[model samples]
Target: MVPRPTSLLAWLLSTLAAIVLIGAGLPGPAAAAATTTGVKFVDIPGDGVTLKANVVAPAAAGSYPAVVFPSSWGLNDVEYIAQATSMAAAGYVVVSYTPRGWWASGGEIDTAGPADMADLSKVLDWTLANTPADPARLGTAGVSYGAGISLLGAAFDKRIRAVAMLSGWTDLNYSLYSDQTRHLQSAGLLGLAAQLVGHPSAELTTMLGDFTANRNIATVMEWAKVRSPATYLDRINANAPAVMIANAWGDTFFPPNQLADFYGKLTTPKRLELRPGDHAIAELTGILGLPNDVWTSVRGWFDRYLKSDANGTQPGKVYLKPDNAAAETWSSWGAQTTSTKRYGLGAIRWYDGTGLLGGSPTTGWSKSLPNDLDTVANGGVVLLTNGISAFTGLRPTIWLPFVDRNRAGVWAAERPSTALKVRGIPKVHLNLTGTAANGSLVAYLYDLDSLGNAALLTHAPATWLSGTAGSRTLDVSLSAVNYDVPAGHSLTLVVDTVDPLYYDANSAGTITVAGGSYLDLPVK
Candidate 1:
């Protein structure tokens, strides 16, 4: 039997009381039997301060499985209420708490340090002792920073039986300083904001300074080397099943390829779910302004693994949303959605006096002329060259939005053949050259099949090229798709410096290119 609020007012009051108690530090039972439901607070020992958490458990009196969610920039207890409520209603215990130095919790927050993992372990032990939670049925889940903590917890805590990580980063060093450019949108701005709000530590401020100045990757890599999860990958408990979910199409924060690399390295019974969306979990649900679908998925996964409940559970399932056709419709893996095809590069082409030959040896490529936002608000310029013949069969179109700019190019390719249906993600590789020592790069996939067609693929952050870069190869994996690239239709890769939707471009650098660049299209 699940616990129910006595009444609407009671539930509201209980929630208010919980909030007040968290803020004021007064020690009274902030909840009643009816509205209090199953939530409680427990204290854990920290290095220099005491750590506390707001825990929600199944209403029934029997021992239940538990899942832990660590704190992020805001109040973890409140941010995870939806998940807590859902998991509790589904008869599981959910623990949401602040990390060492955030809000009500005491001690300093060291981002993703060893101290945080130890704190998480202490919380796990506290939960098992104080509640009717089965110690053998523990799991963890979170998103972004919280997800990072969850990964760390699972790596150190053998008691955790499973984990669901959303948009979690694997190598912090690579994420912050890939290609010697700090990602202004994600690691730069968002990370700075989190530090300011959560810890306000001088160390965090200095770190933010290094990121803002576009310092070399080595500096950022040094910080990441001390805090990355890569060093602890082998420590992940093998008994626990892990589900790594990320948006291959996310343009704001992590690079999609890096996430894929992390997913591939997991030693546990792991799975990867790549979707089309930004970092927000709501995109997975298609419910604008509502709770994220990941919450439901988490509950279901916990129910299946922690409680051994077989209802509505399946393993190794991969879903890809159709591109440009319809929103909210997903196709199962192995379903043919795109026609397999390839596009050739090396064909001599010209764009505004820039002659494209087989290699960079063909000179005359210049930096992209800056266009006002209005000129290329939606997409980049489509260069029409006469030297190259029109493509035949299923082909991909390539377009460069930013010229002579570092980290602001969009590469688009034509859609695949209608007959060859595509079920998985589309991959594009390009051999690029630049005159500058450092720059950023991004790739996008567009669906031209629908009215007001939108981009179908946006990848996580990846290394573009840097350091007196000559010709460098860039491989981008887009979000999973099951759609038809109709006959006569084309898939375009928008190559640019930065995704306007996510980050701003480098206003202070010059990036020039030679004509030997070629985009290799692998459609499956």
Candidate 2:
């Protein structure tokens, strides 16, 4: 497990000091054409405390539809004023509220625990009880934190006619821990953010301690499972609400793979949009002087599902814009296996002491790759950008050199015969053995251009919870991706042990890649 910060002061400083778009300015009426609206404060019977909420009604409204907005993590209900007001103007009895524990709301922070979930149910119930909300036309939408609860609400409460989520995680385990490797920075930052915005409940404080200390994953996972909507997806699908999912492919907090997993399982009237941006782009864009394309599309989604009015047209049925910042849409999310491109790992020495990543797919060779202790000892953040690169403008592609030439194995495809669009998850076939008691294997897939500037596609790691301690052959699936490796650009696959993002074996072991070692990609 990645070690957590030891000092309370360090944790406090990080959370309080680090705020993303807390005060980022939202644009003028152009982004929010929802018109001036009437607003009322509402107090409700929460699980064990009083819940504060807002009811923003369209200026000229009579039993209009209703839409509920939940604040993102660490934010109050008012944080979504622009969104609520805009929806209200569009004829929705817009209801928005802070979760308990934040912005002077009652109760302690549970991180979407039982209390939080119950609070959401009661909030919606109270909204209908007090406001002139059309119970049949109720809808919900939010980003990141709010996006998740909206899904949860729809899953348990069928009264929600429509639901839309952006940058929300479907599975907490997948988002927080992968291959037994805890996403340390993200997990830690989340706890700190919660602390900064809302003081912890006694239970939450204890959970935070276990998390920060890397004490035990079992405890953390159990708590996460209760709050994960994917756990209840089957139920959600059975009595599902009209769903719209806008997942940022590059969001580190909510991996696209998990989002796709949720989208695939939803058996309801649904739409999907996959864009490339970090965690907050869908919500923070309007605040940063950028056109609020995403929010505008969201309004149309509610207009259709909540009001039974298409209002002209909606965003794409299924939007996909991966790398290169270009977008395309389809009817639904499905596995697209374009032709296969295979790159074989060989024994040839390419860079420094590293084995070559470049060769014909037919090449078969056994090569001994050592473990890079120094790189394991001192590996920095893999990239400068936190999650996905921005969608607009031309940005520099990432160039990755071997951390330790001899210890890390580098394999590249012989430059593509033509420029090919590579999409979907790449599979790695490996035959390997351990020289020590136990070991781990890490593989990173990258797109290397003619001049050797490389950009990360996706990576997967495997570790032994407990092992045979000797020779083992394995096939590992890297993270699912929709990246395009252009013409003249070759595919680079790096294999080694240990990554800073994951728990490192920190053990010195040699795992030789036997014959039939190759990287298989989906090429279009």
Q: Against the true structure, whose lDDT is highest? A: 2
Mind giving the per-residue lDDT tens digits that candidate 2 earns over 1-524? Answer: 34554354344334422343353224335424445355567777788887777777766547888888887777766656656656666677877787888757888776766777788878778877877788888887787788888888777778888888877877888877666555655566567767666867887778767865657768888988888889888878887688888876556566677777677778887878876666766556542334576776777788887777868235336777766736766665554545776766777464454455534544456666665343422223322243325645233255556345556667766676776576666788887755455556778777788776767667766665554566666677676667667778877777777665555543655777776677777765
* Candidate 2 colliding pairs: 357-410, 357-411, 357-412, 358-412, 398-454, 419-487
Tell me the spans in candidate 1 whose CA falls farther than 4 Å from its real position. Answer: 1-36, 41-43, 237-239, 244-248, 283-292, 323-340, 345-434, 440-444, 448-456, 459-488, 496-516
Error of 1 at 68 (Å): 1.3
Q: How does each model score on lDDT?
A: 0.52, 0.68
| Residue 516 in candidate 1, Cα distance off native in Å | 4.9
Judged by lDDT against the true structure, how good is candidate 2? Answer: 0.68
Task: State in Å the error of residue 236, model 1.
Answer: 1.6
| Model 2, TM vs. native | 0.87
